[model samples]
Target: MPRMTTERTKTTVRIDPSTASGEREALEQWLDFHRVTLAQKCEGLDDTQLRTPSAPPSDLNLLGLVRHMAEVERGWFRRVLAGEDAPWIYSTQEDFDRDIHAADVDTYEEAYATWQGEIARARTLAADRHLDDLGLGEHRTGERFNLRWIYLHMIEEYARHNGHADLIRERIDGATGD
Candidate 1:
């Protein structure tokens, strides 16, 4: 006989994708859901707690995640999509992981603010563009991706990092939820 076990389902207060009426709307809603989920995971935590790493030899933390996402948002929407000459906000050529490994409690407010700002900018950049619209910039492989591809990629990126955020938040204060 096979062993039986109970599976747990976590509760979340994210946007409902089913309510979205179109392809673009659904993508936006899902991305927003992940973005909010990341923010919610970092809520109620002190600066020090937010900066604490998941474990030894691992620099992953909530604060770093916010900074990293801000960089990502800027890279995809501002630079790639808009073809703007925007520079890195947190990372540098010498330290690419500066956004991740250099998490600082003192810059908590600035980091979150930057992330929110990037999100707003991304929305504005994509608002008037169609899904099939190609980006003004090309990927490192010399290929350009469409706005639809960027949206899907961003959603995947946030989803993956949000999983990390869930683990880090749980380890930080025993908080757990989806």
Candidate 2:
């Protein structure tokens, strides 16, 4: 198969989620807003810069966060919601932290591609499902969750990681914003 090229946007354009939209639309738009926010944080950084740790004690970096989010998207939307038995792209159950700790300059573009692909698949899987529909698989606690809960959790997940991305970006080049 041919490799997919992801043309990095110099500056990301994120639309505000509508205030008057229905529950589903509002949730999706907010989730998308946070998604673009994370991408914006990584904009204009090279692989070396992307792989730079936020601090000596922490291995957190923009690239690692991107890869981690890809895994998150796959786990929640594919493995749980859609019940697709999809294998992980960057880590395994035995060593899930591999996604965050294994960041390398060589895997920069591949990480972005994998992340984007997972996001696309996630959107597809959620499109036809109603907000109240329960996922095909249960959460780690063995409790089933609905699409609504997944969207909210994903939004929270991105929001938290995007905060880290913001700090990492600032540490790299002193750029900062929403």
Candidate 3:
């Protein structure tokens, strides 16, 4: 599952081939829904509250999750899928979990800005490609994939992270559901 930051938000899941503006529209709706759910976990909190570690040995907070998900979004859509350079947002690739480590974020506004920027780029890529279009770049193992695979993989990531946020929110302040 994709790692989640915090917060839940409104979303509709109905995908009508006729109403789906396009494949990108359907995929982006689910992606946006996941982002909104992550935002819901962080609502009504300050930087200190947002950055507080939720459990022992895990400095995971809603803020960190936002950052991490931003990284994930960029990695899959921009870097891996879209063929762009990674911003190296995290300190270490050896530990992907580091992408979500709780920290003293300067402000909630700034974190959201970072996430929004990445999501926008992802949207652009999804818009420009067809469901059957495999990115020009191949994986390290020389394997290639079509846009259809990317959407499925992303859905898996979001579902996993949303589950994580559910547990973390309950641990932080008994917040859960919707």
Candidate 4:
């Protein structure tokens, strides 16, 4: 919830892994690539454009995706992986998709910073841990997952969301690539 003076910026191009030799290297590189992809999709958009929903019937928007991903990063990495007492980024007990409705410019800035912070923390927490190391889940099922599984899940999640971001971005400004 701390506001950062410097805002998070996205690279127009995503970095490709050239020497990902091991499981950890490959997973991390791919995940980072997807993260960059999502950021790239949202680059150069204004607040109103970002807040525009994916059509009349759907409520999905670029800024909403940004906020939602912030929550997802916090949930999986900070809360679940590191077992920190971190609260939800934007959601609540009453409304799970609250983050998805955030629309203002301030919310956009904050969400991007929060997502980047969570990504950094996740990287730090996973750096020393092996891929096979386990993290306890706080869900009702009481499940446990390995770092490798989390990496894979995150990659998938970002990939899927990046696809949505692509559609939303194109719809917003008719910009399309990659």
Candidate 5:
């Protein structure tokens, strides 16, 4: 699942596809829905509220989730799918989980900007390519993947993270629902 951040204005309500006519359109719509959902989950929260963990003995905060998602978006879209030499925005090789710890307002702002930028680049890259077009995978085996798979994976990622976000948001201030 992707992670989330704190400190966002209320997101515009998602306009779910009424009747997507093709695979690309359907995939894009679903992805966009999940993206908006994540933003909505973090709405009306300050940095401190976002940084509060979901439960004891857990570091899974909303702000950490946002930072983590930024890393995930960059890793998949920019680095792997786009074939760019992009690096992790928050985490490092020595500590891939670094993004999930100790965030502030500035960190939230930077992470949100980076995540949105990556999303824009991913959209642009997808617009120029066919779903069947392949990108080299970043794993040790050097496999390849299609844009379709990436879209599905991102949708799945956001869906899962949004579940966590729901719980965290409810715990934070009694806000809940799809």
Candidate 6:
């Protein structure tokens, strides 16, 4: 397949319309907002601008967060939901907090692509199941969790990272989160 030449945009999200009612809408909205917010942090930047670390000790950068998040999306949707048993691109069942490695632009692209693909897949999964349906999976512990856990977890993850990206983008080029 030909590689998509079009870059990501804050307004280009591909969320499907909801058939079920209730908190699914809020959860979906949060997910949608964070997706755009995440991309906003990445706006108007070249490779060099993206790679530069945000502040003093934190190694988190816009591109690196994208890389890390992409890995997370893949892990949850492809490996967990689909039960592929594939090793995680970020961490093969290890601590996901350490998945912030983006060595170069190519690495960022790969990671981001991984995330985008998985996001699409996860949305498909969500579309088929109502929010009440059990989404069986495990935490880092041996304990199992349901689909609700996954939805909440992903939203938390994205929101936290979007906060990080807010400061990083501002420092990078006087940009602010919307």
Return the top candidate by TM-score. Answer: 2
- RMSD of candidate 1 to the truth, in angstroms, is 9.0
Tens-digit lDDT string for candidate 2 (1-178): 2232353557778999998999899999999999999888888876677778899899898888998999999989998898777887878778878888763334667887898999999999999999999999866687888899999999999999999999999999899999
Candidate 3 Cα outliers beyond 4 Å, as residue runs: 1-25, 93-96, 105-107, 140-142
TM-score, structure 1 vs. true: 0.88
For all predicted structures, in order, the TM-scores are: 0.88, 0.91, 0.77, 0.89, 0.89, 0.78
- Those runs of model 2 whose alpha carbons end farther than 4 Å from true positions after fitting are 1-9, 103-105
Of 3 and 4, the candidate ahead on lDDT is 4
Regions of model 5 farther than 4 Å from truth = 1-11, 104-106
Which consecutive 10 residues in model 1 have the weakest lDDT in total? 1-10
Per-residue lDDT, model 4, residue 13, is: 71
| Residue pairs in clash, model 5 | 3-65, 4-65, 4-66, 5-66
Worst 10-residue lDDT window, candidate 2: 1-10
Q: Write the per-residue lDDT of candidate 1 for residues 67-161, one digit (tens) a residue.
A: 99999999999988888888999888889989986533336667889999999999999999999999998665778889999999999999999
What is the lDDT for 159 in model 2? 98
Alpha-carbon RMSD, candidate 5 = 4.0
Clashes of each: 0, 0, 12, 0, 4, 1
lDDT (C-alpha) at residue 87 in model 5 = 72
Better of 1 and 5 by lDDT: 1
Which parts of model 6 have CA positions greater than 4 angstroms off?
1-21, 92-98, 105-107
Superior candidate under lDDT, 3 versus 5: 5
For residues 51-141, what per-residue lDDT tens digits would candidate 3 score against the true structure? 6666778777777778777777777788767877776565476776666764443455666788888888888887878888887666557
Candidate maximizing lDDT:
2
Q: What is the per-residue lDDT of model 5 for residues 64-104, given as tens digits with 9 covering 90 to 100? A: 88888887777777777788888777787877788887534
List the pairs of residues colliding in candidate 1.
none
